[model samples]
Target: MDKIMMWVMAICALIGGVDQLAGNKFGLGRRFEDGFQLLGPTALSMAGLICITPLLSLGLEHTIVPLYRILHLDPGMLGGVLAIDMGGYQLCKELAQDPAIGRYGGIIVGATLGCTITFTIPVGMGMLGEREKPLFAKGILAGLCMHPVGILTGGLMCGVSLGKLLFQSIPVLILAILLVFGISRFPDGMIHGFRIFATVIRSAGTIGIALGAFSYMTGLQLLPGLTPLDEALKVVSSIGIVLLGSLPFAEILQRLLKNPLEWIGEKIGLGRNGTAGLLVGIVSALPVIADMKRMNEREIVMNAALLVCGTSMVAAHLGFVLGVDAPATGALLAGKLTGGIAGVWMAWRIMK
Candidate 1:
């Protein structure tokens, strides 16, 4: 019965996509009923988010671990993460600057917080009394600013502080930044793989690389270990880690900061719950993001906002992986996921 209830919720959440469509419908709704006018960038962003889940699920299990261990210098693995992060951040940042992308800032604001709260806070809760816990949190954030969070966590696990590590990483960070920038400049046509169905194939390629590395280095003798099903979840989880960790959770945060009222409003039951519902609606309304709003521009903005909030789950989940124990990642993930999706839906009803 518990499992059934969860399935029911998931299904209901998925179906919220329809609400988005309905919201956009002519004459009676928010304003932008004709869904056909949705922005290409927004649609592309939606497709990218949806596509990554399945792709990550497909192949990383067999590849990533071995590759990372073997080379002990897996630039490809790190580079892939950086490329995706930089591209998405740069794109969203640019979008935010455009008045066209500015209106739906609320959704983006929600999504960013969702991912951050989900990933980071839960980890924080666990480390409350632990002597080493604070170090871990500081390490993770500092690492994000200085190096890949994973590597930084790995370093912190090795007992190094960011100040001690930053000088050593200057060369690497500069290189990573350049690599990401270069990838971003790829001919828009070449990069359009994110749009094409074949892009899934491309994404899975990274998984294959990562898994192959993991297995070869570990020397795991089990035959079943190489199977696709065996690796699917782990691989997908890691890509998810990268996505949740890398997305513009902070920028979304900046936008939210811009509006202090949300803080006061939350006291009256209009803040967190409202944001969660909006996110729930976003996941449900992917196929028809434009339907969630009456204005075309607003619809596009809403979709971006939703994507940002959706990333909270990743942020919270990462906290767990980073080793913060007390405020467990499990609790944070659940709370944020619930809050993010619920927030969006609530916003829809209340605002309308």
Candidate 2:
């Protein structure tokens, strides 16, 4: 199975790489990018769990066990909130606002806002999924505009509080949708500003992960009696390991899935590389990026829109790692796919 999967990945990478070298939009077909996108998060998270958080979030057991055991909390519903919150934070803050996006604080805001406040799987995935900053902007706007059918469904599965759901979560969710609609009225031209608040934050992604990894290793508390440094550090470590040692496997995995994904995509009537896109997370968009036929600007943007707006294995994994209940987990998976498709179609119409 490993060999077969590896062969698949290699062939996919080769085809995608050839397509890209011949003048494709963004997918360059390097093992480096592919590996970083797929394995980066899991690697960083695992290293952190083993080192920093002291197994507080070691596995499903540690992450959600506390909800049931120590805190005497409902692992199903409230866990959904935490799951959504963590996944959103990871995607929006940690992953968005990259070099691909601008370096300004506003880009961060734009990325976060465009990716949607509550639904943020796109920000991270878009970093690699399309690698085009404008598409990120467009997709973010589209993602934020989506209705919270899946989110509400997930919350319901988790047994969330009725009043809180109706009043707090539902209200904010509606407001966010309104914001997206409002933003849609803005012009489509790209403008630039020269001020960058903190150039350091731009590079801080891998650095943050490294610092967290070091902290995890040495058991050092940079700030005593402060926030949960250990947990924070560990999560950072997990996010940072993309460069450390996760790319090779990520590249292999990307290649293996390409042909099958493309085949599935053709069946579904998604241009050409649709399935490749369905699987395109942050950086491993080689399948879509390398497709020679759909190299136009609109095609590129649409492909990314689909991934961020439609697919979200990353969010699902984060929820699973955090020990969200099965019902909530199902909601996250189903909701992102459904919402993403809706967002993509809407963005297509909104594009002017």
Candidate 3:
């Protein structure tokens, strides 16, 4: 089922890319508006359990578990992830505004936040045990987590009242729609906010896991207030890992994928390589031709075509090597490679 959904998402990306290449506009009345339309649904739906089920566990812990035995607070988990996504978004946005950093901040921040926030839902859901419950509790929990205090702060700056705006049931529904739609229409906007948050919080789960392993290995307890220095060091280490490790990892992938067409040209016959390359380059390069940074739609087809061939070949090669034969793998690889190229292109675009 998971694999099936993955393929579905890939297909949507392919279709969307093709549409952009053909100069077709989505019903949303914007060229880039449909960018996330399909993938967002699959991600959110698959992550539904995570967003809602935690509330069930929280409720059960308070009602059933002995006070002395209650070891965890679910709110902290929800709030923490929300906070991380928020912090990463803010940090990236700030760096993007800097002349020295500019768009470099945006890519690092956006990718980290985007991947984390989207990945969190599924990861959280998987951590749960079977227990079905009412939707009200889930809805309320989802609202709170989705609109953490920091998100509200930013929304307020944009004239959106996170509390009052999201409290009403109708408004909540509207916000849900917007959240999904906004993902597609302005993926970077969503990522911008999430990245800043992720960077800030750095994810408590990640910290907890690290601390647990460290404690086991060094025979040191990880209790709070016991070692402030240790906690601070851990935080610093995580930050360094993200900045030096994660960012560089992405860069390495980009470098590895460079001249993907040339790689395919070497592997496959030239004719097959050329056809595949043309299709991918046309689709993948839309962001460039569309002038996505400032938001323009003209010249997108030609520019996107070039990018698609060059980068989509990377995805195809990735799929080939991974033995990914599903239609979805094709779509995902196509989208992933395109995204990588888009990131590099955006970086170059901003640099110039």
User: Can you write out model 1's per-residue Cα lDDT over 1-352, one digit (the tens) per residue?
Assistant: 2233234323432333344456623221221212112223222323233223333323443555355335443212221221222122222222232321211111221223323222222322232334323322222222123223323333333333556434333434564455334323542332243234234434444454454446556855323333332343343343333322222232233345444635543543444433332333322323223232322322232223333223334322322222212112333334334444443343333333
- Using TM-score as the measure, name the better of candidate 1 and candidate 2: 2
lDDT by residue for model 2 over 33-127, one digit each (tens)?
A: 44336444544333332232222223434455464445432222211211222332332222212321111111122222223332333223333
Q: lDDT per model, in order?
A: 0.32, 0.39, 0.31
- Model 3 misses residue 226 by how many Å? 12
Model 3, 4: alpha-carbon shift in Å?
27
> Local error of candidate 2 at 176, Å?
3.1
Summarize candidate 3's per-residue lDDT along 294-341 as a digit string, tens digits.
322211222222331133232222222122122223333333334444
User: Between prediction 2 and prediction 3, which has the larger lDDT?
Assistant: 2
Q: List the candidate 3 regions with Cα displacement exceeding 4 Å.
A: 1-77, 80-178, 181-230, 261-291, 294-352
> In model 3, what is the error at residue 60, expressed in angstroms?
16
Better candidate by TM-score, 1 or 3: 1
Candidates' TM-scores?
0.29, 0.46, 0.24
Ranking of all predicted structures according to TM-score, beginning with the best and ending with the worst: 2, 1, 3
lDDT over C-alpha atoms for residue 39 of model 3: 29
Q: Cα deviation of 228 in candidate 1 (Å)?
A: 6.8
